[model samples]
Target: MSARSKKINNMAYGKLCLLLLILSGLSLTIHAKLSSNFYSSTCPNALTIVKQEIAKAIKIEARIGASLLRLHFHGCFVNGCDGSLLLDDTSTLLGEKTANANNNSVRGFEVVDNIKANLEKACPGVVSCADILAIAARDAVVYYGGPFWKVKLGRRDSLTANRSAANVFIPQPSFNLSNLTSSFATVCYKLYVVLGLCGHTVGFARCTSFRPHIYNDTNIDSAFAKSLQNTCPRSGNDNVLQPLDYQTRFRFDDKYYQNLLVKKGLLHSDQQLYNGNKADSLAKKYAMKQGDFFKDFAKSMIRMGNIKPLTGNNGQIRTNCRKPN
Candidate 1:
């Protein structure tokens, strides 16, 4: 054909390709908006109700596991909590068996899987498994009767699981304040900032219907309880106990700060959160601000869910959550 005709055909094809690209971009934008809207509208209600369901499941599972004396892992990876941590490597000779052990993390997954099944029935694949983990973590907190705050959703799962990440991320229950601060700092969260953040979730969880059972008292009746009565005399009544002591046991109360005033706090790391005149002032500020705490909790949960997620077939859907390939 003529060179002029060929040039005209090439131009037409180029224009057609550009048009298709534009259309694809627009479609993606619309889909993303719709997904966000769905997340906003459905997440809160589903989270609230599903949290209770998860609480029930975990509690029942915990009770059963306690009778069995099983150990469980707690906390999440940057992306979200993967129940795989609960798998018992001892159960199989070559790590090819199904994970059926009972730990809080495993129970939490069972609870979450139940929630996932329900959400799938309600909204199909719209809700991600990672969001279920976020909601279930809160629910697990509630199941242990710790605290139940509103968890923001739409978290994507991690394609890769990290045992090293687990080692790095999970805070030691008995960690000192400085070490705890370092743990938070690993994720760019400062200790003072974290204490403020904790005040949001911890205070709300305590004040609400949820309760957490705190354990390990090195000097509860002796030194810790005595300090409680000395600080905040109005709130501190008994020499052995105070409103603050109650805070440690109850996850849904502002008493954590109150308790901080008493024994100085449950975790050795927690003391740093309230130490120093500046930290003391921040603690007081957090103690007085309930609404601020709630708002911060919502924001933190949303941020937590977005950490290093796997997308677009980067991760696989395990037929069994406990068994990893």
Candidate 2:
């Protein structure tokens, strides 16, 4: 090429390099908001303390592990991971506890309260309830024999909770495949959403939530559906519960995907994952590969935890997890 052409190409390459540098810098700035060692200086033992408490809780009630994980999801899905779900309704602040999706459903507030008390004693106002939820989630997953991942901390508690937002954002058990896909896609991609749903591998659903699927749905296995129907009656006793994955309800494995393959998923939303849709292929892949399921679930959880977080000087660290400081 001529000197002039060479000079033009060189200029274009320099511009491209500068653009790449700028993009890289932006990415770092965003990532710096939440660091794995965010509490290294302020509360070095934050994770250790949280894990200790979680171990105690899990020992007493193994299902608490799933409940704690659900708490993190409930908090993160609405207005970001700002600990809004933990807030109790005050005279002026309406919390998420009474939200349609959360009322009488979400549990493990006492576990969070216990963790926050210990954290306050250790680091006073340094650790945020939001961060505690994030850490506790990882600890809960690991405690239940799930894959472990380092939680990115530094999130702050929200000053106010939005019950309306919680009702609107939290996915319902009755959602169809399209609705479920759209709900999770709001936070990340469809694949990550499916991985996140793998959390169901460890938990149970109340009869009220799964009654329709067990009694009315035609997709579920007849024998499995009949068994659940015995537990969850037709008329009343909505509080009765059944495992989401009856095969391995207490273990964090890919049996949830296996359950879906045979139409044994206890929730309509879950069965939708393998109902011959876009997510069906992926569900089959996870069911066949437990290792892949665990790996993707951990990665997807980390992504979900990184949703819109309140970091830096925004929000506050609540001394009481149920109330703002």
Alpha-carbon TM-score of each model against the true structure: 0.55, 0.89
Worst 10 residues of 2 by lDDT: 21-30
lDDT of each: 0.41, 0.80
Which candidate number maximizes TM-score? Answer: 2
Tell me each candidate's RMSD, in Å, in order.
16.3, 9.3
Q: How does model 1 fare in lDDT?
A: 0.41
Prediction 2 global C-alpha lDDT: 0.80
Model 1, span 1-325: residue lDDT tens: 8998976765554444324322331111111111223366554356656656655664554442211111112334322333334333542322211221111222334554566667766666556655555555555544443434555434344334434555565553345444444454434333224322353222111111111112234423345534433542433222222222343443444555555544446444454446553346545755676455444444444444344444445454343334433
Clashing residue pairs in candidate 2 are: none
TM-score of 2: 0.89
Give candidate 2 misplaced runs (Cα > 4 Å). Answer: 1-32, 189-192
Which lDDT value does model 1 have at 192?
A: 24
